[model samples]
Target: MYLSDKVLIVEGKTDKRRIEEVLVEPVQIICTFGTMGVSKLDEILEQLDGSEIYILSDADKEGRKIRKWFKKHLSESTHIYIDPKFGEVGRCPRDYLANLLMRHGFYVDTSLIMKGKFYDERAVGDTGYIQSYSL
Candidate 1:
Protein backbone atom coordinates (compact mmCIF):
# COMPACT_ATOMS: atom_id res chain seq x y z
CA MET A 1 0.00 0.00 0.00
CA TYR A 2 2.81 2.33 0.78
CA LEU A 3 4.40 3.23 -2.53
CA SER A 4 6.41 6.36 -2.08
CA ASP A 5 7.77 6.13 -5.59
CA LYS A 6 4.61 4.88 -7.29
CA VAL A 7 1.41 6.88 -7.57
CA LEU A 8 -2.15 6.01 -8.51
CA ILE A 9 -4.20 8.28 -10.78
CA VAL A 10 -7.91 7.87 -10.16
CA GLU A 11 -10.99 9.47 -11.70
CA GLY A 12 -12.75 10.87 -8.66
CA LYS A 13 -12.76 11.32 -4.90
CA THR A 14 -15.03 8.33 -4.20
CA ASP A 15 -12.61 6.00 -5.96
CA LYS A 16 -9.75 7.55 -4.01
CA ARG A 17 -11.62 7.09 -0.71
CA ARG A 18 -12.49 3.47 -1.57
CA ILE A 19 -8.88 2.60 -2.32
CA GLU A 20 -7.68 4.40 0.78
CA GLU A 21 -10.07 2.38 2.94
CA VAL A 22 -8.51 -0.95 1.97
CA LEU A 23 -4.86 0.07 1.70
CA VAL A 24 -2.56 -1.08 4.53
CA GLU A 25 -0.15 1.81 3.96
CA PRO A 26 -0.18 5.28 2.49
CA VAL A 27 0.14 5.49 -1.27
CA GLN A 28 0.02 8.66 -3.34
CA ILE A 29 -3.41 8.94 -4.99
CA ILE A 30 -4.36 11.57 -7.54
CA CYS A 31 -7.95 12.23 -8.53
CA THR A 32 -8.21 13.73 -12.00
CA PHE A 33 -11.70 15.08 -11.29
CA GLY A 34 -13.40 14.01 -14.52
CA THR A 35 -10.78 15.60 -16.77
CA MET A 36 -7.18 16.57 -16.37
CA GLY A 37 -6.83 20.32 -16.62
CA VAL A 38 -3.75 22.14 -17.82
CA SER A 39 -2.69 23.05 -14.29
CA LYS A 40 -2.49 19.37 -13.32
CA LEU A 41 -0.07 18.55 -16.11
CA ASP A 42 2.99 19.70 -14.19
CA GLU A 43 1.88 17.98 -11.00
CA ILE A 44 1.25 14.68 -12.75
CA LEU A 45 4.52 14.91 -14.65
CA GLU A 46 6.36 15.57 -11.43
CA GLN A 47 5.15 12.29 -10.05
CA LEU A 48 5.90 10.54 -13.31
CA ASP A 49 9.57 11.44 -13.06
CA GLY A 50 11.44 8.52 -11.48
CA SER A 51 8.12 7.03 -10.29
CA GLU A 52 5.80 4.36 -11.57
CA ILE A 53 2.33 5.51 -12.58
CA TYR A 54 -0.88 3.51 -12.48
CA ILE A 55 -4.10 4.73 -13.98
CA LEU A 56 -7.45 3.63 -12.46
CA SER A 57 -10.14 5.08 -14.66
CA ASP A 58 -13.88 4.48 -14.82
CA ALA A 59 -15.60 2.16 -17.31
CA ASP A 60 -17.45 4.98 -19.04
CA LYS A 61 -16.62 6.71 -22.33
CA GLU A 62 -15.01 9.69 -20.65
CA GLY A 63 -12.85 7.39 -18.63
CA ARG A 64 -11.72 5.62 -21.78
CA LYS A 65 -10.70 8.92 -23.35
CA ILE A 66 -8.58 9.75 -20.35
CA ARG A 67 -7.03 6.31 -20.49
CA LYS A 68 -6.10 6.99 -24.09
CA TRP A 69 -4.45 10.21 -23.04
CA PHE A 70 -2.42 8.49 -20.34
CA LYS A 71 -1.47 5.72 -22.71
CA LYS A 72 -0.31 8.28 -25.22
CA HIS A 73 1.54 10.31 -22.63
CA LEU A 74 2.98 7.47 -20.60
CA SER A 75 2.82 4.19 -22.45
CA GLU A 76 5.22 2.56 -20.05
CA SER A 77 2.75 2.89 -17.19
CA THR A 78 0.34 0.13 -16.26
CA HIS A 79 -3.41 0.52 -16.10
CA ILE A 80 -5.88 -1.17 -13.76
CA TYR A 81 -8.65 -2.21 -16.09
CA ILE A 82 -12.02 -2.10 -14.37
CA ASP A 83 -14.54 -4.44 -15.92
CA PRO A 84 -17.56 -2.59 -17.29
CA LYS A 85 -19.76 -5.54 -16.29
CA PHE A 86 -19.11 -4.72 -12.62
CA GLY A 87 -19.87 -1.04 -13.13
CA GLU A 88 -17.60 2.03 -12.86
CA VAL A 89 -14.55 2.45 -10.69
CA GLY A 90 -16.49 4.04 -7.83
CA ARG A 91 -18.96 1.15 -7.69
CA CYS A 92 -16.25 -1.52 -7.59
CA PRO A 93 -15.90 -3.59 -4.41
CA ARG A 94 -13.00 -2.96 -2.06
CA ASP A 95 -11.78 -6.56 -2.38
CA TYR A 96 -11.59 -6.30 -6.15
CA LEU A 97 -9.63 -3.05 -5.96
CA ALA A 98 -7.34 -4.52 -3.35
CA ASN A 99 -6.71 -7.53 -5.55
CA LEU A 100 -5.96 -5.27 -8.49
CA LEU A 101 -3.62 -3.19 -6.38
CA MET A 102 -1.87 -6.35 -5.21
CA ARG A 103 -1.15 -7.19 -8.84
CA HIS A 104 0.75 -3.89 -9.04
CA GLY A 105 2.82 -4.81 -5.96
CA PHE A 106 0.76 -2.93 -3.41
CA TYR A 107 0.21 -4.25 0.11
CA VAL A 108 -3.52 -4.25 0.61
CA ASP A 109 -5.78 -6.55 2.59
CA THR A 110 -9.26 -6.81 1.09
CA SER A 111 -10.68 -8.86 3.92
CA LEU A 112 -12.21 -6.23 6.13
CA ILE A 113 -12.13 -7.30 9.78
CA MET A 114 -14.78 -4.79 10.82
CA LYS A 115 -18.35 -5.32 9.70
CA GLY A 116 -18.61 -1.62 8.97
CA LYS A 117 -21.82 -0.68 7.13
CA PHE A 118 -22.56 -4.12 5.75
CA TYR A 119 -25.93 -5.65 6.69
CA ASP A 120 -25.80 -8.14 9.53
CA GLU A 121 -28.28 -10.83 10.46
CA ARG A 122 -29.96 -8.42 12.85
CA ALA A 123 -30.46 -5.87 10.08
CA VAL A 124 -32.42 -8.37 8.03
CA GLY A 125 -36.17 -7.73 7.75
CA ASP A 126 -35.62 -4.16 8.90
CA THR A 127 -37.22 -1.61 6.58
CA GLY A 128 -34.40 0.92 6.87
CA TYR A 129 -31.64 -1.54 6.14
CA ILE A 130 -31.80 -2.13 2.44
CA GLN A 131 -30.04 -5.36 1.65
CA SER A 132 -27.49 -4.67 -1.07
CA TYR A 133 -26.05 -8.17 -1.41
CA SER A 134 -26.55 -11.78 -0.47
CA LEU A 135 -24.00 -13.81 1.48
Candidate 2:
Protein backbone atom coordinates (compact mmCIF):
# COMPACT_ATOMS: atom_id res chain seq x y z
CA MET A 1 0.00 0.00 0.00
CA TYR A 2 2.29 2.68 -1.25
CA LEU A 3 0.96 6.17 -0.67
CA SER A 4 1.04 8.33 -3.73
CA ASP A 5 1.67 11.32 -1.47
CA LYS A 6 5.00 10.13 -0.08
CA VAL A 7 7.83 7.78 -1.02
CA LEU A 8 9.11 4.98 1.20
CA ILE A 9 12.51 3.60 0.33
CA VAL A 10 12.95 0.08 1.68
CA GLU A 11 15.45 -2.74 1.43
CA GLY A 12 13.50 -5.30 -0.57
CA LYS A 13 10.19 -6.72 -1.80
CA THR A 14 9.30 -8.35 1.53
CA ASP A 15 9.38 -5.02 3.34
CA LYS A 16 7.31 -3.42 0.61
CA ARG A 17 4.66 -6.15 0.73
CA ARG A 18 4.50 -6.16 4.50
CA ILE A 19 4.16 -2.39 4.80
CA GLU A 20 1.58 -2.32 2.03
CA GLU A 21 -0.44 -5.07 3.71
CA VAL A 22 -0.80 -3.11 6.93
CA LEU A 23 -1.33 0.35 5.51
CA VAL A 24 -4.83 1.81 5.20
CA GLU A 25 -3.94 3.45 1.89
CA PRO A 26 -1.51 2.72 -0.90
CA VAL A 27 2.04 4.07 -0.42
CA GLN A 28 4.84 4.53 -2.91
CA ILE A 29 7.66 2.22 -1.90
CA ILE A 30 11.01 2.19 -3.67
CA CYS A 31 12.97 -1.02 -3.37
CA THR A 32 16.75 -0.85 -3.33
CA PHE A 33 16.87 -4.50 -4.48
CA GLY A 34 20.05 -4.83 -2.39
CA THR A 35 22.32 -1.81 -2.61
CA MET A 36 21.06 -0.05 -5.67
CA GLY A 37 23.61 0.92 -8.26
CA VAL A 38 24.55 4.58 -8.62
CA SER A 39 23.44 4.38 -12.24
CA LYS A 40 19.93 3.37 -11.24
CA LEU A 41 19.50 6.19 -8.69
CA ASP A 42 18.67 8.74 -11.37
CA GLU A 43 15.47 6.89 -12.14
CA ILE A 44 14.41 6.88 -8.51
CA LEU A 45 15.07 10.60 -8.24
CA GLU A 46 12.86 11.19 -11.22
CA GLN A 47 10.01 9.27 -9.63
CA LEU A 48 10.38 11.09 -6.29
CA ASP A 49 8.07 13.92 -7.39
CA GLY A 50 9.05 16.32 -4.57
CA SER A 51 7.25 14.24 -1.96
CA GLU A 52 8.66 13.47 1.46
CA ILE A 53 10.83 10.35 1.47
CA TYR A 54 10.99 7.89 4.34
CA ILE A 55 13.77 5.37 4.70
CA LEU A 56 12.91 2.18 6.58
CA SER A 57 15.65 -0.40 6.50
CA ASP A 58 16.76 -3.42 8.50
CA ALA A 59 19.23 -3.09 11.40
CA ASP A 60 21.84 -5.39 9.96
CA LYS A 61 25.09 -4.42 8.26
CA GLU A 62 23.76 -4.33 4.74
CA GLY A 63 20.74 -2.36 5.85
CA ARG A 64 23.06 0.24 7.40
CA LYS A 65 25.09 0.39 4.23
CA ILE A 66 21.99 1.02 2.23
CA ARG A 67 20.82 3.65 4.69
CA LYS A 68 24.11 5.46 4.46
CA TRP A 69 23.89 5.54 0.70
CA PHE A 70 20.37 6.94 0.76
CA LYS A 71 21.31 9.54 3.39
CA LYS A 72 24.23 10.71 1.31
CA HIS A 73 22.24 10.90 -1.90
CA LEU A 74 18.84 11.79 -0.51
CA SER A 75 19.89 13.99 2.37
CA GLU A 76 16.55 15.53 3.13
CA SER A 77 14.57 12.47 4.22
CA THR A 78 13.31 10.87 7.37
CA HIS A 79 14.76 7.53 8.43
CA ILE A 80 12.54 5.12 10.36
CA TYR A 81 14.00 2.21 12.25
CA ILE A 82 12.41 -0.64 14.16
CA ASP A 83 13.62 -0.89 17.75
CA PRO A 84 16.34 -3.53 17.70
CA LYS A 85 14.95 -4.81 20.97
CA PHE A 86 11.99 -6.23 19.01
CA GLY A 87 13.70 -7.55 15.87
CA GLU A 88 14.29 -6.94 12.20
CA VAL A 89 11.33 -5.74 10.14
CA GLY A 90 11.11 -8.99 8.12
CA ARG A 91 10.83 -11.23 11.21
CA CYS A 92 9.08 -8.72 13.49
CA PRO A 93 5.48 -9.30 14.54
CA ARG A 94 2.91 -7.60 12.33
CA ASP A 95 1.10 -5.87 15.16
CA TYR A 96 4.41 -4.75 16.60
CA LEU A 97 5.43 -3.30 13.30
CA ALA A 98 2.03 -1.66 13.05
CA ASN A 99 2.56 -0.06 16.45
CA LEU A 100 5.89 1.28 15.34
CA LEU A 101 4.20 2.80 12.33
CA MET A 102 1.31 4.16 14.39
CA ARG A 103 3.81 5.95 16.60
CA HIS A 104 4.45 8.08 13.58
CA GLY A 105 0.73 8.75 12.88
CA PHE A 106 0.32 6.08 10.21
CA TYR A 107 -2.69 3.77 10.65
CA VAL A 108 -3.38 0.28 9.46
CA ASP A 109 -5.96 -0.56 6.79
CA THR A 110 -8.75 -2.19 8.75
CA SER A 111 -11.90 -4.10 8.00
CA LEU A 112 -15.41 -4.62 9.49
CA ILE A 113 -15.07 -3.69 13.13
CA MET A 114 -18.30 -1.75 12.60
CA LYS A 115 -20.87 -1.43 9.89
CA GLY A 116 -19.48 1.61 8.11
CA LYS A 117 -16.62 3.05 10.11
CA PHE A 118 -13.07 1.82 9.74
CA TYR A 119 -10.82 2.67 12.73
CA ASP A 120 -12.68 4.05 15.70
CA GLU A 121 -10.36 6.46 17.52
CA ARG A 122 -6.74 7.13 18.39
CA ALA A 123 -5.14 4.17 20.14
CA VAL A 124 -3.60 5.09 23.48
CA GLY A 125 0.12 5.07 24.36
CA ASP A 126 3.26 3.95 22.52
CA THR A 127 1.82 0.58 21.56
CA GLY A 128 -1.01 1.90 19.43
CA TYR A 129 -1.57 -0.99 17.04
CA ILE A 130 -5.12 -1.46 15.78
CA GLN A 131 -7.60 -3.56 17.73
CA SER A 132 -10.72 -5.10 16.23
CA TYR A 133 -14.05 -5.26 18.02
CA SER A 134 -16.43 -7.51 16.09
CA LEU A 135 -19.84 -6.01 15.66
Candidate 3:
Protein backbone atom coordinates (compact mmCIF):
# COMPACT_ATOMS: atom_id res chain seq x y z
CA MET A 1 0.00 0.00 0.00
CA TYR A 2 1.42 3.34 -1.06
CA LEU A 3 1.09 6.52 0.98
CA SER A 4 -0.59 8.30 -1.91
CA ASP A 5 -3.27 5.66 -2.05
CA LYS A 6 -3.74 5.75 1.70
CA VAL A 7 -6.46 7.50 3.70
CA LEU A 8 -5.88 9.92 6.53
CA ILE A 9 -7.88 9.31 9.70
CA VAL A 10 -8.43 12.35 11.86
CA GLU A 11 -10.25 12.99 15.11
CA GLY A 12 -12.89 15.54 14.09
CA LYS A 13 -14.41 17.71 11.37
CA THR A 14 -12.03 20.58 12.05
CA ASP A 15 -9.08 18.24 11.59
CA LYS A 16 -10.55 16.98 8.34
CA ARG A 17 -11.00 20.52 7.00
CA ARG A 18 -7.49 21.50 8.04
CA ILE A 19 -5.95 18.37 6.49
CA GLU A 20 -7.81 18.97 3.22
CA GLU A 21 -6.61 22.55 3.17
CA VAL A 22 -2.92 21.65 3.52
CA LEU A 23 -2.55 18.40 1.59
CA VAL A 24 -0.93 18.73 -1.82
CA GLU A 25 -2.91 15.88 -3.27
CA PRO A 26 -6.47 14.70 -2.85
CA VAL A 27 -6.85 11.84 -0.40
CA GLN A 28 -9.69 10.47 1.66
CA ILE A 29 -10.10 11.97 5.13
CA ILE A 30 -11.99 10.13 7.89
CA CYS A 31 -13.21 11.60 11.14
CA THR A 32 -13.68 9.69 14.39
CA PHE A 33 -14.86 12.47 16.63
CA GLY A 34 -16.82 11.61 19.77
CA THR A 35 -16.74 7.95 18.82
CA MET A 36 -13.94 6.47 20.84
CA GLY A 37 -14.55 2.89 21.73
CA VAL A 38 -13.64 -0.65 20.80
CA SER A 39 -16.63 -1.05 18.49
CA LYS A 40 -15.94 2.22 16.70
CA LEU A 41 -12.30 1.24 16.22
CA ASP A 42 -13.26 -2.10 14.78
CA GLU A 43 -15.79 -0.46 12.47
CA ILE A 44 -13.30 2.10 11.24
CA LEU A 45 -10.61 -0.50 10.68
CA GLU A 46 -13.04 -2.67 8.75
CA GLN A 47 -13.93 0.25 6.55
CA LEU A 48 -10.25 0.94 5.93
CA ASP A 49 -9.80 -2.57 4.56
CA GLY A 50 -6.09 -2.75 5.35
CA SER A 51 -5.29 0.30 3.28
CA GLU A 52 -2.35 2.50 4.20
CA ILE A 53 -3.39 4.83 6.99
CA TYR A 54 -2.04 7.92 8.71
CA ILE A 55 -3.35 9.16 12.01
CA LEU A 56 -2.92 12.85 12.85
CA SER A 57 -4.25 14.20 16.08
CA ASP A 58 -3.55 16.85 18.69
CA ALA A 59 -0.34 16.82 20.75
CA ASP A 60 -2.11 16.84 24.07
CA LYS A 61 -2.85 14.19 26.68
CA GLU A 62 -6.22 13.22 25.18
CA GLY A 63 -4.60 12.91 21.78
CA ARG A 64 -1.96 10.62 23.24
CA LYS A 65 -4.63 8.38 24.74
CA ILE A 66 -6.42 8.15 21.41
CA ARG A 67 -3.16 7.31 19.66
CA LYS A 68 -2.42 4.56 22.12
CA TRP A 69 -5.82 3.03 21.66
CA PHE A 70 -5.57 3.26 17.87
CA LYS A 71 -2.14 1.68 17.89
CA LYS A 72 -3.33 -1.19 20.00
CA HIS A 73 -6.17 -1.88 17.58
CA LEU A 74 -4.80 -0.91 14.18
CA SER A 75 -1.26 -2.07 14.60
CA GLU A 76 -0.60 -2.17 10.87
CA SER A 77 -1.46 1.45 10.14
CA THR A 78 1.12 4.20 9.96
CA HIS A 79 0.47 6.78 12.64
CA ILE A 80 1.85 10.28 12.83
CA TYR A 81 1.21 13.01 15.36
CA ILE A 82 0.46 16.56 14.25
CA ASP A 83 2.02 18.96 16.70
CA PRO A 84 -0.15 21.42 18.59
CA LYS A 85 1.23 24.34 16.58
CA PHE A 86 -1.23 23.47 13.81
CA GLY A 87 -4.22 23.88 16.08
CA GLU A 88 -6.48 26.94 15.89
CA VAL A 89 -6.92 29.11 18.98
CA GLY A 90 -5.19 26.21 20.76
CA ARG A 91 -8.61 24.56 20.50
CA CYS A 92 -9.38 23.78 16.87
CA PRO A 93 -6.58 21.85 15.18
CA ARG A 94 -4.99 23.42 12.11
CA ASP A 95 -3.59 21.99 8.87
CA TYR A 96 -0.10 21.40 10.17
CA LEU A 97 -0.67 17.70 9.77
CA ALA A 98 -0.18 17.94 6.02
CA ASN A 99 2.97 19.96 6.48
CA LEU A 100 4.39 17.33 8.83
CA LEU A 101 3.56 14.58 6.36
CA MET A 102 5.28 16.50 3.59
CA ARG A 103 8.37 16.80 5.77
CA HIS A 104 8.54 13.05 5.64
CA GLY A 105 9.52 11.26 2.39
CA PHE A 106 6.28 9.32 2.03
CA TYR A 107 3.99 12.06 0.66
CA VAL A 108 4.60 14.42 -2.26
CA ASP A 109 3.60 18.03 -2.67
CA THR A 110 1.79 18.52 -5.98
CA SER A 111 -0.38 21.64 -6.32
CA LEU A 112 1.49 23.46 -3.53
CA ILE A 113 -1.64 25.01 -2.16
CA MET A 114 -0.95 27.54 0.62
CA LYS A 115 -3.95 27.98 2.91
CA GLY A 116 -4.41 30.34 5.88
CA LYS A 117 -4.17 34.11 5.91
CA PHE A 118 -1.13 36.36 5.87
CA TYR A 119 -1.32 39.85 7.39
CA ASP A 120 1.02 42.72 6.54
CA GLU A 121 0.46 45.40 9.16
CA ARG A 122 3.73 47.03 8.09
CA ALA A 123 1.98 48.35 5.01
CA VAL A 124 -0.27 50.43 7.20
CA GLY A 125 2.74 51.76 9.11
CA ASP A 126 4.58 53.01 6.02
CA THR A 127 4.01 56.68 6.73
CA GLY A 128 6.77 57.93 4.39
CA TYR A 129 5.43 56.09 1.36
CA ILE A 130 1.83 57.04 2.00
CA GLN A 131 2.37 60.65 3.00
CA SER A 132 5.23 61.34 0.51
CA TYR A 133 7.55 62.32 3.34
CA SER A 134 11.32 61.99 2.76
CA LEU A 135 13.87 61.43 5.48
What tens-digit string does per-residue lDDT give for candidate 2 at 1-135? 333577888888888888876666456888887686787678788988888888888888878887888889989988889767544566656666665565555555443222222223455435664453232
Candidate 2 lDDT trough over 10 residues, lowest sum:
111-120
Clashing pairs in 2: 1-20, 1-26, 1-27, 2-26, 2-27, 2-28, 3-26, 3-27, 3-28
- CA lDDT for candidate 3: 0.57
Give a tens-digit lDDT track for model 3, residues 9-100.
77788767766655555567777783578888877877786567877667666677777888887777777755466442124323334335
lDDT of 1 at 27: 73
Clashing pairs in 1: 1-107
What 10-residue stretch in candidate 1 is worst by lDDT? 113-122
Quote model 1's TM-score.
0.74
Model 1 lDDT tens row, 1-135: 344777888989998988888677667888888886556756687756667788989998878987888888778888988778766777877766665666566656535422443313342236643233211
How many residue pairs collide in each prediction? Answer: 1, 9, 1
TM-score of each: 0.74, 0.74, 0.64
Cα lDDT computed for each candidate against the true fold: 0.71, 0.69, 0.57
Which one wins by lDDT: 2 or 3? 2
